[model samples]
Target: MSIVKNDLADNSLNDPHRLLRNMIDQVPDYLFVKDLDCRFIVANEAVARIHGFESPDDLTGKNDFDLHDASSAARFSQIERQVIRTGVAMIGMEECVVDAASGKERWLSTSKVPLRSANDTVVGLIGISRDISARKRDDFLRDEQTAILEMIVVNSPLHAVLDRLVRLMERQLVGVYGSILLLDDGGTHLKHGAAPALSQEYCGAIDGLPIGPGAGSCGTAAWLGESVIVADIASDPLWKNYRDLASRHGLKSCWSAPVLSHDGIVLGTFALYSARVRHPEPAEINLTQIATRIAAIAIERKHAEDKIRHMAYHDMLTGLPNRSLLTDRLTQAMLQTKRHNPWVSVLFVDLDNFKFVNDSLGHTAGDELLKTVARRMENCIQPTDAAVRMGGDEFVILLTDLPENTDAIAAAMHKIRAAILEPMIIRGREFHITCSIGIATYPQDGTDAETLIANADIAMYKAKEAGRDGFRFFTPELNIKAHERLALHDGIRRGIAQSEFHLLYQPQVELEFGRIFAVEALVRWNHPQLGLINPNEFIPLAEETGLIVPLGEWVLYEACKQNKRWQDAGFEPITMCVNVSARQFHDQNWTSRVMHALGETELDAKCLELELTESLVMRDVNEVIATMEELRKVGVSFAIDDFGTGYSNLSALKSLPVSRLKIDRSFLRNLVEDDDDKTITAAVISLAQKLNMKVIAEGVETHEQLTFLRENHCDEVQGHLFSEAVSSTEIGKLLQNQQSRSGLAPA
Candidate 1:
């Protein structure tokens, strides 16, 4: 648009309006003036050109409706009227106006002022506007991109984040298509990272592309540790082999950038694809680099999360399910079974003598064996079943969806037992491991995860008690028996601590004289809760718990003191016999403890006899022989108690430094009725004689039993046939009576 030269010269020299007009023409911003009728009165070259007019003379008389569409004209008129009536300036108003020159909507930052006449009345509005479309568009895109990235970081997982990133880049670039490829763990190949817009068949074809020179844009980018832009896939040697694959997917060009870690190590490649043959602009290349950086962040985060989760749920040694995951899976299995009414068996398996392996071999070997067991157990169960390592040699298998029957559960357990029994070579030695399995089924043994697992563990102990290399099913009776055994163990421990034990003496009479020569000290538990508990009930429990060591010491001291007291009272000096448990016999301080008891009581060692069961003596024969010799040197005699019950060899028997053998009560009770017992008892007597040991027959309840013992030349007899085991006072009376009856011999 042109300004009048005379008016401009006049304004430039003297008029302030002429100077203002020249200044407005020098500015690039669109400048205009409108009348009260909303018609353009004055316009600069920039405003006239934007309205498709050659000069201001062509645009001056046009109204807002002449330059813009009707809707745009109405909006402009409304704002102009408000400015004119209020006589206030409207500043920095933003509007979307259709450019009359291009017919394209452009965002503008505009200002309007109410022009007043000399009478101080509003005459029209003067406007100043600038095209801000590019700035506004750029700002909007940046905010949108920042929001998308924030959402990805906060909510999306690794792969999903990568997928969203690629999709967003594609949308931002309009027609550009892209994909993300990650380096495999081995760093040898490119794997499908994310390509949401790509077809599955195309992704599959390019998924495992090797990372090397001439291996396509992504592969080459990863191989070279830089960006690779293939202007034409069909012609570029990098895509020589992959050209046909790319062509088939309608991709003609590809640009790839290596995704790098913070240390600049190549993590993967990000690529943009195009259907038309072309090279990427600098902006597109930068976009790919940014996408690659984001992909690396997402992938590294995912890997870290996976590693933590894996460690949480998996056994570090065996790579089997740990207790935490096992419990979770078991709970799920139980829930499923409850809904479907199918049997879900929880099998608690403990490798028998696993400690022996760890003790004999090192824990390294033990770990190898456990890993092998995990693999074997895995092989035994179905894919759906979970094999869990419940820590150290204890494993549980959750067998799901089995038929509701014992047979099905038994079959599964059989497979597991067989699998574990298979021989393994550890530390160059062939070894075999046996496992005890306990099966607890859903809705039968228990209903919940904890109950089922606990019951299964309880049954496993039962299997161990029955003997290892076996399996047991959980039953209500087994549960009762388990609780009873636990209570008995506790009771035995309490009884020892509280000194609830008292000794009763069963006289070992001289068979020929019919006189009480010696007495066997038998322990009885004076339970405050259950009166007079038998030795059989708690003795084994005491041995198992190692309480027998202290209990045996108490018995020894009590018996020796009682014998010394009788001697002090001017009664007959009698030898005292005290029973020693297997655990007590194995105590390294056993001989010392025995001597200490004798010393405290001031009883002669010759008058103290320690009776050990043959089974106990037979175990570690050399050790037992040494122990016997130690006691024998101190003038303490040894007797193999319940001699015939155990399978101690006769040769081993001869080596023991013993003075007597007590026939077990079983043989004595059935001596006349059972010929087997008769033969065994007779053989025991003969064996004792050959070994230079005296024989004592216990439980001689009848005359026939005593007659059999007497005829067999048994040295001592102790049973109800003479008198039952009696308290200390009762035994004193019996000793006195026996002394009086010593004048008469047996008929």
Candidate 2:
């Protein structure tokens, strides 16, 4: 289209300039012409609308600088100057432009072409621009959404992403500021997640906002798990508590959407606040929903990550740090030693007799006891110290910055003991549990966590060996003993497998008839290198290492075999007794094993007896009774060994299918010297007679002790007074002598 001469004055239909103006006015792309001096000569309707002009004529005589910001105007001038000077067109130049009509930031894709006179000289510039502001805004929002997605995927801190999200939301919607509120851990309260545009005081006032009905926009949204739009906060009942606070912060209209996980559980809320009182438009509501979904993803992902982290570092049962976390913390503590030179003490604790609780009261009560003890242990230490359950009845305390003197360590150990021994009532029964603790200090007990923990464990064993209910510090001697104990444990394991364990039978004589009644088989380990190791030295260790189960089975089989050998050798078929450890008795299949042993040896079940300690029998009496009944059905008898030394439940004992009760040797050792021993011996005999069970006094060594037991009507005696625990051959000779003395001949 071209402008004709005298077109401004022409009234005819063939006015070229008027025709060009009419054509350009219908085009949506902005069209304008500028003279050599950069003055706007003509513009189309699109350009006029953008420039806030009523008509194309209103832009006439205006330069780019007059309509655009200085930077944009300068760039436009340079481009137009180049087009006018060089007759070159600049095409599709993207630029940030200030919209003259609304004074808003806009993006435009602009092209400038030179205008030529009839003489072929560059006269002015003609520019066509397409407003691309909406595309630019959409791209910006897309980037923001991408960033949010990255934050969720990479496990970035949730708050940082939410803060970025609210900022993006505020910038996207004019006259709207945004906030995000997250549900607290308990899911009963809302905490301020991010509110950059809102005042800190306003955020503080709304933080810890309870999630319930009528709890303002975000709180109510979270509580209801739905969107809540308040046209006017001043009048909305939901904002009654927060209206004044919002008014002070110049917030009026509020719209909120619950941030919900895919499972429909509310995680948080996304909200927008307007200074003006008005309902949210459809577009604003849609934005709120989009923001809420993003917020939900971030919140849920963070919660899941946190839960996983907690599970990794924490014990599920006691909620204390697990081995993994303990190792990590101990490593860190060791690292800190070089800089601060502080003492780091590791206390290894083993709960004494904890198995009794599990056996007697059930594991449920045992668990309660452990958790309660864990709490008490935590209370005994400083807040900076850590107490952790190192799995089942074993705990460790990491103490930092302790004194050089041993007093503090001793005091802490004492505190731990006292705390554990404090009477705990569980399942309607009171219990006093004891713990053996060992202490290992940094720099002295080795420099690393593993060494320190190992040493502490070594000391713990020392404490237990010292009779338990105590604590011991790691010493040089303990290290040697620890190594020896380890060797012993290995030896015991090998002995059981290699059949290195042998039995020593002590004949139990019928006091009235002077005939052999039974022989108790005592296990003796003939270690190839260590020689004959007494049961006292290794029996407890076997129990601790869970070696007792297999070892006990070996003893049972060996005792049954030896008894069968005696019977085959034409000796009396007296009952052969085997001692059972608590660990062996607690084995669910113990009765079956005994039957198997008897079956394998082909020994008469009537000639076999299983001896259990008072404590072991009292633990889970019902289970003991059931086991005893099963054995009794096969004619196997039961004996309560170490009778008065353990906490025996007399009532439960009455229900046991026991054939004999053996008085503990400790009572008999002082039988003549102590009146208490004499009285206990007499009382046991009387009780056994009343229950139709024979009483046997063990460890009898002198005439006075044997006379006391006989006068007390003890049905049998098994001690040095007759013979010590001797070899099978020695016992065979003694059995022969006893049978001969009783006027019987051994084939």
Candidate 3:
């Protein structure tokens, strides 16, 4: 190339061919200049080389129609006409063309500009073209990848992430079709997720493919936890057996990569199949590895979520539904009952005296006992009914479709009681426990969850108050009594401050002599407005409201003081019997309370007898015996109050240290006429005599009952036949008169 002086001085303008030729040679893009008749006038070296020509001369003076197929020529003409008609440059026109001389297809991205003379007449066309085959192929790959990504994301719920990676490699690498085979639940089989598009029939045929060393490509990959390649499916042992099926579906080769969890547990395999025998490209292998990692994360996350949800609703201690889930179920059940107007019952159960067992036997034993109780409760209810543990020692049952009447509920309660009371052997020790049940019915007790629970709780407490190991229904009367108990609690507190309580004496006399043998000390509460209240009304109220401890102390102090006064007034010492409630009897300070009362009043312990009901003695015989022995050491005699009315075993009675058994007044009410009553009394008297224990016939109001008691040789008697429970002042007067008449009073 030679440079001229004019060209150097005015580089902007020069000979047209020289300027065009220089621009074409300097540009990296391929450029060509064509005349109006479509003959190539000039061509850049890059354009010549792009068409596999050795020199520009070979490309110049040649039209696209001479070098291209009709389809390519038509596309070129369309671009040239567009530029000439608009007199504008056509930018970035992409087309695929087959080189006429080389017979090879190449993609060209071309831009054409209209060439004109100085007078503004169209002279020719100038074109710029780039060999973009690589870019075009990459773009095609990206579009295919995007479509496959969407398909996997939408279809492969189990292996979407891994399936997409496999599909991407299959599209980007030639001669490859993809498959994702996940391990089945048994861990011995491979199940297809997304299979090769070309081998659909083959994949379907081996959908539930087995896994082993040489079962198949996917099976071998999963078994070895590595990649497996069958370069020729017909010859490789891994697919030797499946060669017929593969040949039928036009599959000749397969490659597989093991899909594994983060911990290296084989989850499945990612496989690719080829219609013609071939090896996997490096890009395909790389994508398979990436997909395996993603699959591991997704599968692990799903499994973790499921495990957590399972644990949240179950109790770890007993494998039962915990309080949270159980309550939710109960609320739903209540809603169903309300909507359907069906019968439903909620049972509130509390173990009877569980605290004692826990305290005496340590918490380990207590825990074991609770587990045992949970199992028994689960057995007691129907499958439709739910037995829920509301934490320690408390259980609630939601029962539906109960019988029309409350009898079924009662029967269920009894069954529950029986189940719980069955003896349990824990830590080589046989233990027996019972439960107190409170039942609240739908619509009758409450319609809502909270109201039903509250009513059930109230009824449960009522069961405890009525002496435990029993069941009670929620009733209006119980609610009234609960309110009255609250009122009495407040009243007792006020009474203690105002000194409104007093003691009365009920005379216990010998039926033969009409002489007083002992005096039963009873408590009286003067309510100021209500005049006087009997002990029966306030005593139980005091016990329930936990006011008995203080009230009982007051009674002991007042009774001992009264007894000492009568003795100081020269009347003979008479045994004063005081009723002890179960609550008071269970108090650890009871023995101390009695000793303090005796010391404070200077009264003899021999003259004081503590009366307890039959049920209290049967609760824990050994503990009761220990308590009785402690009291006996201080000269306090014992008596069983209202005997023959409870579940008292004859063997247990023989072992107790009680001095006398009081026949319940009901038996004596018609003792002379009713054969059953007479027989009961006779048996009691005979048993007492045989055991050398004294028998007291209480509530004897008539002389006929008195005569019958005398004939039966009953040891002592106390009732209306002698006198009613009277005030202390009247009791003192009667004692003085009796002492004077017997000539045993001071002169």
Top model by lDDT, which number? 2
Rank order (by lDDT, best first): 2, 1, 3
| Highest-scoring model, TM-score | 2
Which residue ranges in model 2 land beyond 4 Å of their true spot? 1-23, 84-88, 116-123, 327-345, 352-385, 398-435, 441-452, 467-470, 480-747
Better of 1 and 2 by lDDT: 2
Better structure of 1 and 3 per lDDT: 1
Q: Per-candidate TM vs. native?
A: 0.53, 0.56, 0.42
lDDT agreement with native, every candidate: 0.84, 0.87, 0.80
- What TM-score should be assigned to candidate 1? 0.53
lDDT of 1 by residue, 1-747 (tens): 145777656557457776677777778888888888888888887887778878777987788888777998898899898888888899999988767787766788999998888998888878899999878866765775676567656756667778778887886574678899989989999899889988999999989989999999899999999988888999889888989888888999998999888788888988899989988887787677677777777777666777878977898899998877987999998888878888898999999999988889977899999999999999988888999998778999999999877888888888888888889988889998898988888888887776788789999999999978898888998888667776777787788789889898988888877777789998999888888888888887777556788888888899999999888877878889998888788665788998899899999999988898988887679988998898899899988898788888778888888999999998877788899998888888888898788999888788888878878888888888777788989878876776676622333
Better candidate by TM-score, 1 or 2: 2
RMSD (Cα, Å) for all candidates, in order, is 24.4, 20.6, 26.8
lDDT of 3 by residue, 236-349 (tens): 888877889888888898888887887888888877788888777777677667656655655555556556666666655666676667667778877777677778899999
Which regions in candidate 1 have their CA more than 4 angstroms from the true location? 1-28, 42-77, 94-107, 115-123, 131-142, 157-164, 167-174, 181-215, 222-225, 240-251, 263-268, 331-343, 353-369, 401-415, 418-432, 481-747
